[model samples]
Target: MSFIGIDLGTSSVKAVLVDDRQRVLATAARELTITRPAPLWSEQAPADWVAATLETLRRLKDTAPEAFRRCAGIGLSGQMHGAVLLDARDEPLRPCILWNDGRATAECAEIETGEPASRAITGNIAMPGFTAPKLLWVRKHEPDIFRRTRKVLLPKAYLRLVLTGDAIEEMSDASGTLWLDTGRRDWSDRMLAATGLDRSHMPALVEGSQAAGRMRPELARELGFDAPPLFAGGAGDNAAGAVGLGAVDPGSSFLSLGTSGVLWRTTAGFEPRAGSAVHAFCHALPGRWHQMSVHLSAAASLSWWSSMSGQSEAALLGELGGQIDRPSPVIFTPYLSGERTPHNDPQLRAGFLGLGHDTDRKAMTRAVLEGVAFAFRDGKEALEDGTSPIGEAMAIGGGARSDTWLAILADVLNLPLRRYRQAEAGAAFGAARLARLACTGESPEAVCAPPSGEADIFRPHPDRAAAYAERHALWRRAAEVSHALR
Candidate 1:
């Protein structure tokens, strides 16, 4: 039997078909647009997501009708922290407020004032990217819509509701909304009181691998399949990526370099960082939690630099490859779109420090790579608390495609970086693995195994590690200066 995994991302909806042995059979994607009618506000029509999902599934059916018909189960993974409000009739009241939209900063501030109690109750600090603040924003500004709201769901959960008609969310995705009791794996009553919402407005919570429902007969027919079992409640994109990369075990970790960059570490129990810098979320793996450090601009920064300079990422890396032997004094702060972990400041901006006449494009490029590494290190230190050192971390996404960047990351992290054989498909592949486990009643390890590839291990050189440590201190100082100036 084959399994289908659907990743409903911020920019597109992607569907992948994988065989029982975990080999991808067919893939399809449909891009969707985010509308910004006003500054700092981002929205997407829920109908648009449904339409794209349908079209993407249609493409998958067209690609291999026989394989599509043999699909045994379907799983979903999507962007986290987006708010999708539904009316009593289950119709969306308005366009979803996306994860990137920052209009709820004021509400975030209000929630933070009660941080001590909030953290005790929700196991997280309020952030504009979370769902509660966005919900409050809707409640305060769009009262009529708020009154009509019957269900509050995340991006993927909304899609899951449409797919399964169950109106439920998984614990992994719930952890991102700042409304979940991370320790208990349930919605926080304190958060509900603070937000002036009731528990009834939220969807029932399920474990990541639990079967939510069967595919709607209509959707099944559309995809040329019988009613396949639907595992609608999978996980947030990051957690799903971890599942994809086989980073489900404690001490297993991975770095994702997608639109956002993240350093994910799986742990057995809840280990909340004293400071709310790192996000502690429920992992897709049963009874496990993951701590994450996020960089808002990871691959995005590289993309911007490459696009502005009219250089392909490969070309830029090729140019910088020559300068790796020579150290440059320049240091870049990868806060182009502000920052997430370590420093939760959105007003902060990217900057270049130690630049001089001798600084060249190659040096600048190196700084960009190291800067992101430094940010990751900052988050690592905050989350580590001298508890457990990450033994090895798998690398995925576009940034991992570069050996030089991997070297920089390995040196800065001072840990072995293992490049996955199947790169850039972490989320989709993970969803398929989860679907397999759900359908077959097998352990994740039995269903998912690390792919065999040429291993490129980067060990830290003592000298470079020391140099990076020094540069990290300077980077922290620069962040303080930048924040003050703002």
Candidate 2:
């Protein structure tokens, strides 16, 4: 039998077909646009996501008809924390307020100040990226839509409702909404009261692997097959990525370098970090939790550098390789999009300190790489304080494709970095693995055999590690100065 896994990302929706033995047969992808109507506001039509998902599946069916027909189950993973409101008739009330949209900062502050009360309900402080704050934004600015709302679902849950006629949310995705009790794994009545939203408007909470419902017969027929068993409840992207990296056990961690970067580790039980340096949320794995620290501008910073200089990434890396004659004295702060971990300071701006005419493009490139590594190190230190010590981390994502950057991360983090083979394929593969386990009664471990590929392991150089320690102190001071100015 075969299984299908879909990753509904911010920029695109990707579908992968895999057999019971965990071998991928074929893949399909469709990109969607994120519409920005104003500054600090990002939105996307829910209909766009639905259309893209259907087109992707149709393309997959044409490419692998046999695999598509033999598919026994389907799984979904999606971007986290977007708020989608629907009217009483299940029609979208407005474009979804995306995760990166910071228009709800004022509302977030209000909820944060409401503190102990907010904590009592959601087990999390209010943040602009969460659903509750976006809901409040609607109530204050677009009260008409808020008034007509019958339910609020995150991005993937909204798509699932359209596909399967089920209005249920997985715990992993719900935990990011600031409307769920992280400790209890359920909707927070206190939060509902605080947000002035009735609990009835929320979907029922289900475990990530639970079967929410089967695919609608019409949807199945449209794709040229009978309705397949659909696993409505899956996970947020980060949680799904964690499963992809096999970070299901305590102390196992992964570093992701996508448009944003993150350092995440899985744990057996819920453990919220004090002061909110790291976000603690439910994992896709049952009865487990994960802690994550995010850097809003990780790979994006590198991409920006390439675009500004009109140089390809490989060419830039080659130039930087020639500059290894000596360590560059420049320090960069990777806060172009604001920071999420350790600092949690959204007002801070990116900067290049200690720059001189002598500082060549190589030095600038090296600084960009080092800056992201420093941010990751900060997160790793915070997670260490709250949970088990991180001895090593598996590197995945577009940035991990660079050996030079991986070496920088290893040196900065002072740990061994292991690059997984299917770095970019993490979430979709993990979703497929989850579906296989759910359908065939196979253990996740049994299904995810050790990846077979050459892995470059970077060990920390003691001298480089010491150099980074000293530079990190200066970076922190510079960041504080920048924050104060803002």
Candidate 3:
């Protein structure tokens, strides 16, 4: 049988069709737009998500009719920490506040002060990206909408509601809401109270790998389905990507160079870092936990450079690859959208130091790449220095497409990195695996198997490692001083 995996990503909603053998049969994507009504605020209309899903599924049906008809289950993965408020009729009260929105900085500080137990329970630093702070921002700034909010759901859960008429919030995604107790894999009463929210505003929780609900029969038939497919409790995009990359086993880890970069490792039990930058959250599968160190911008810095320079990524990188003979004298800090991980400060801004008359577009490009690499090194060091030590990691996402960047990353962290076959399929492929487990009762180990084959390997260069080590140290000291000045 075939299964469908729908991933509600920030830029688009992607749907993948996979057979029982875990081979992707067909895929579809619909682009989405993020609206910024004000600086540091990101919003997306919930109705657009529903429309995107339907359009994507329709495309899947039209493109691969046989695979679509044989579909046995559905799974969902989405951008985490988004707040979708619903009124009494289950209609969205307003556009969702996304994971990257930084307007809630003051609200995050409020949460840290009012809810001292937050870190102990959620196992996360109170960053403005989390849902609790966004809610607090709404409560303080838009009280009327806060009062009308009868339900709070993440982006994928809102899509799940439209598909199955059920309000399902999976564990892995909910863990990022700052309202869940990561150790218990459930919502914390105290956390809810801290946000002036209650159980009534929350959805029924489900394990990330378990079945959430079945598709409504009428809706299934209208979509030209042969049966009402079982809907699985899919994970957050990072965990889903881990499953796709076969990083479920303890100690298995990956470094994703997406819009926001993350270094995550799987563990057998919860390991909360009381005052560290590490984030402890439940894994997609039950009985397992994962820790993450996040950097708010990774490939995004490159995107910014490309846009500002009017150079395509390929052109910029092509120019950049030729400059390996020497390191750029400039040092850049990639705090363009503020930062998380080691420095939980949102007001921090990005800057470049040591620019001279000779500095050109190519030097600036290399500096931008080097800056993100250093930020990633910061996270990797935080994780390795903490309870979890990462020896190696699978490299995935848009930046992973750059051999030069990945090589730079390898030396910066001095860690071996592997790229897997079908690495670009990412979260949607893993969501499809979750769908198989939910419907066919297949073990995660069997369904979410490690990469059937290896594609590439990147190892550190000793001389470059030493050079980057010195530069990285300088970056940390300079960043501290810059943050202080900010």
TM-score of 3: 0.97
Q: Write the per-residue lDDT of candidate 3 for residues 1-486, one digit (tens) a residue.
A: 999999998889999998877777888999899898988888999889999999999999998898898899999999999999999999998999998899998887788899888898888888889999999999998999999999999999999999999999888899999999999988899999999999999999988778999999999999999999999999999999998988999999999998889999998899876366678889989899998888888898898888988999999999875425445788888998888888887778888887999888888888888889898888877787835468889999878988888888888888999987687888998898898888878688887787867568989988888998888888777687669766
User: Order of candidates by TM-score, top first?
Assistant: 3, 2, 1
How would you encode candidate 1's per-residue C-alpha lDDT over 295-324 as one tens digit per residue?
A: 888877887788877888888899874325
Off by over 4 Å in 2: 322-327, 448-454
Residue 264's lDDT within candidate 3 is 91
Model number with the top TM-score: 3
The window of 10 residues in a row where model 2 has the poorest summed lDDT is 319-328
Query: Going through the candidates in order, what is the number of backbone clashes in each?
Result: 1, 0, 0
Q: Model 2: per-residue lDDT, tens digit, 1-486?
A: 888889998878988888866777888999888887986678999999999988888887888898897787888899888999999989999999988777787897777676456654554556777889998899999999999999999999988898889898888999888888887898888777677887899998887766776788877876776546567367888787877777878767888887788898887777777365578888886788888887878887897788987998788888875314224588888887667777765566788889887878888898888888888888888778744678888888788888888888887788898986665687777777777666766666676554567877888888877878778888778777668765
Error of 3 at 105 (Å): 2.1
lDDT of each: 0.81, 0.80, 0.88
Clash pairs (backbone) in predicted model 3: none
